[model samples]
Target: MGILSRILNRRADPPRQTRMLEGASGKRWPSTPAFGATGSEVLAGAAQVRGRARHLRFNDPTAANAAEILRTALVGYGATLTSGAEETDSAFADWAAAVHLGELEGEIIDSLATDGEALIILRTDDRGALRLQHVPAEQLDESYTVELGGGRYIAAGIEYDADDQPIAYHFRPARPTDQYQTFRAPIRVVAADVLHLFRRQGAGQTRGLSWFAPVILPLNELSQLQDALQVTAKIQAMMCGFLIDQNGGATSPLGDGESPLDVSLEPGTMRVLPSGWDVRFTTPQQMAQSVELVAVSLRQIAAGLQMPEFLLSGDMRGVNYSSARTALIQFRR
Candidate 1:
């Protein structure tokens, strides 16, 4: 009777609810970051963001200018490394010259500008000489992570110890086509042998956001609007006037039955019209505001990128020597 009573008193699991957290506005939001997205889902979104940022470097003028500004400030002439030990400094200098570290450093800076992160692999060649290889951040196997006994987690290629300190990196080797290929087992290396440079914003953030990520959407829309304005202006200039006959049954400009006239206008060209025919010109609104609009958009983008507006647009109109110098100094800071 005791055993039967114990079995009968056991409880079953409750049913799951669709609603999660309720905000002040009385709206329910999913109880998860990235809208309840899994780690793999977040990684997929990150991959798309990285690809868009890379393409914007070539396709978007504002992005190109921002990249150049960052490159110049961070590593225009390359960074110099100094060591307290004379012997170590001299030996490293020799190795740097052999590997063209000056040039490679500039490339690394460019990568950071476009991709938001750069990976450097410190390796020893067959002859025992140290070699450095640059790998894209996307190639890091974010899926190859583990959770330790404590509250620490390893998401992506990085492995953190119990104290949340990075201890190792897992990398998928590059393929012959220079594309990222998943390996059966990623190459695991100690954190000391790899340098992962990036700007971290949020606490516990695993990846960096692109430098131009903030202004990308607005800048792209502005660029498209400017292009449309320019095309409209050109079309208005080409179409001067249209000829229309007031009298009925007028002969068409093209020889025989009611054909439309095909004509090209040149600077010094002349055309003769019939007696009852008149040429009416179209008057489009003056687009002087367009110039100001473009300038304002450029200024906003430049401010976001921490660069001088004139430098981004290549226009020095109304900017005197003193103002230019002042802007440059402030931007440097």
Candidate 2:
């Protein structure tokens, strides 16, 4: 092309615009991740995360109470039938009572909070009266995904059609850990026959992650720290420490000039060490007196779960009524 023609083409071209996010540039670029994980990776890792959360729920008071607090706030005392359909209401109440619906609701809430998901298997009695069963959400195997051609597929144990809406669920009748039942094939149930409860956070996400995911690591670390402190407290209480002999004694002062002594002391026991020897009790510091660090971890957990630190830790040291009220009002909203 002629120089004049090229100049005209260059003038017609759009201006160059280079865009780079601050977090994704220069020294930060390599560390700043562009996650390509599947949308349901949360579901994929649910079982292990659920197991840890359940352990905390059963054994850790803070974790257990977190779920309890949520359950109380969300489904306090269950629902009441006050619609004023006297005859119909009474019958509905009776049916609800027969199925223990009130308690069932609370349990379901607990499941969702603690397990990140819940399932209510709808059933009927011999006479065809409706009943409800609350089972572990893990009953639905998230690993059981399959393609069935024509846009019909099972993703995260849920069956979806061309439009990607759930029409059924596949689950194990027995716990996945049950060795005897491990060989049993998954049982498919229509979506209408089950109530799948979960806190959906992302679009096209087929499974729910346990609410504990954000705080699980911190809680576990805190638990370990507290445990270490407890053990340290026990050793500190009894003066259980190692003996350090500065004079390089052949044997422990408490032992004949043979192997080092294995001494056990009780309360109020008076003992003397060799003139050149001293006791260097193996008593470790109580978690470096990390009371504040522990409090900080609890706060992290509370923040992750969106609960008041006072509520989660039961520490009212700095909580005044006004502060608590302000926090709770925001929470209740």
Candidate 3:
């Protein structure tokens, strides 16, 4: 089955929350410490700009219309409008920072030079203070002026070409992908390993009930299975289907003891006895975890079996025994 279909039918789990670090003030500390890049290495790669705008809706008879008006105003200035109080509230802090920076740039540019275009480079310091740099496009070869507190000024050299004009640099805010490069590496690795194991199982003519069951067997047994198939991996990644024969079609409950012959194994000719029944052993969360574990085993099985690409396509469908008879054959080699 396709990814979406699998995801929809897959058992639900509780939301995952991150572990927080507590501070002396007995509050959870923010992870990133500061808003923007700190050192030169970080600053060197910081090329994009961010802008934000906000509007409040008063308790008027036309509150709906007023909210729409505010949304339009924000969107006109390149803000992605979202729904509800909490949605906007969650986004407000980031939006406020961008708006503040944009305002600071506009004010500083208005103050320093009149003739040429001036771009304000606003960066949040390690202490979360907004640092402003005023750059005149025409005199890019010369040093730009940075505004410190209490009339103190610092001159920083601009790292731009002479021909580089300060155009309206539109900000496309960085996403989760941009912020964290190595974030999803572990999950991807796990998924890949699981896929590999299932592929191996497809190569061997093992008539197992489900992909998960055979993989959960003892390591020695796994080795024997691998040896028997002449493959590197011991487990096969097979899709297990649970279907029940009710009325005209399969009507198997997802859990155990609900129907006879509930479980069906794929890519082989093994038929489950008694046609339909719930194979109950664990909770949904446990089942999900088992699915991942089985996936890992299948990778090993595929490697051991030296399965060809066509056999290891990783397509397992769960349906009633009656419904699957014709469909299962098509997937089987």
lDDT ranking, high to low: 2, 1, 3
- Residues 184-227, candidate 3: write the lDDT tens digits: 21111111111110112222211111112222233234334435
TM-score order of candidates, top first? 2, 1, 3
Span of ten consecutive residues with least summed lDDT in model 2: 250-259
Candidate-wise lDDT, in order: 0.76, 0.82, 0.34
Query: What global local distance difference test value does model 1 have?
Result: 0.76
- Ten contiguous residues minimizing lDDT sum, candidate 1: 32-41
The reply for model 1, stretches above 4 Å from the true place, is: 1-45, 81-90, 148-152, 179-184, 244-259, 264-278, 282-286
Instruction: Give TM-scores for every candidate, taking all chains together and pairing residue i with residue i.
Output: 0.75, 0.77, 0.16
Q: Count clashing pairs, candidate 2.
A: 4
Best TM-score among the predictions, by candidate number:
2
Select the stronger candidate by TM-score from 1 and 3: 1
Decoy 1 TM-score against native: 0.75
In model 3, the worst 10-residue window by lDDT is 48-57
Among these predicted structures, which one has the highest lDDT? 2
Candidate 2 residues 1-333, lDDT tens each?
999988877866679875567665667578666655546577667788989999999998788889888888788778778888898889888998888888989989988988888998898989999888887887787779899999999988899999988899998778545766454588999999988888877776677778999999998898998897778677677767777768675344665654455477778988877688777766455457577788899899999999998988988986798989898888766
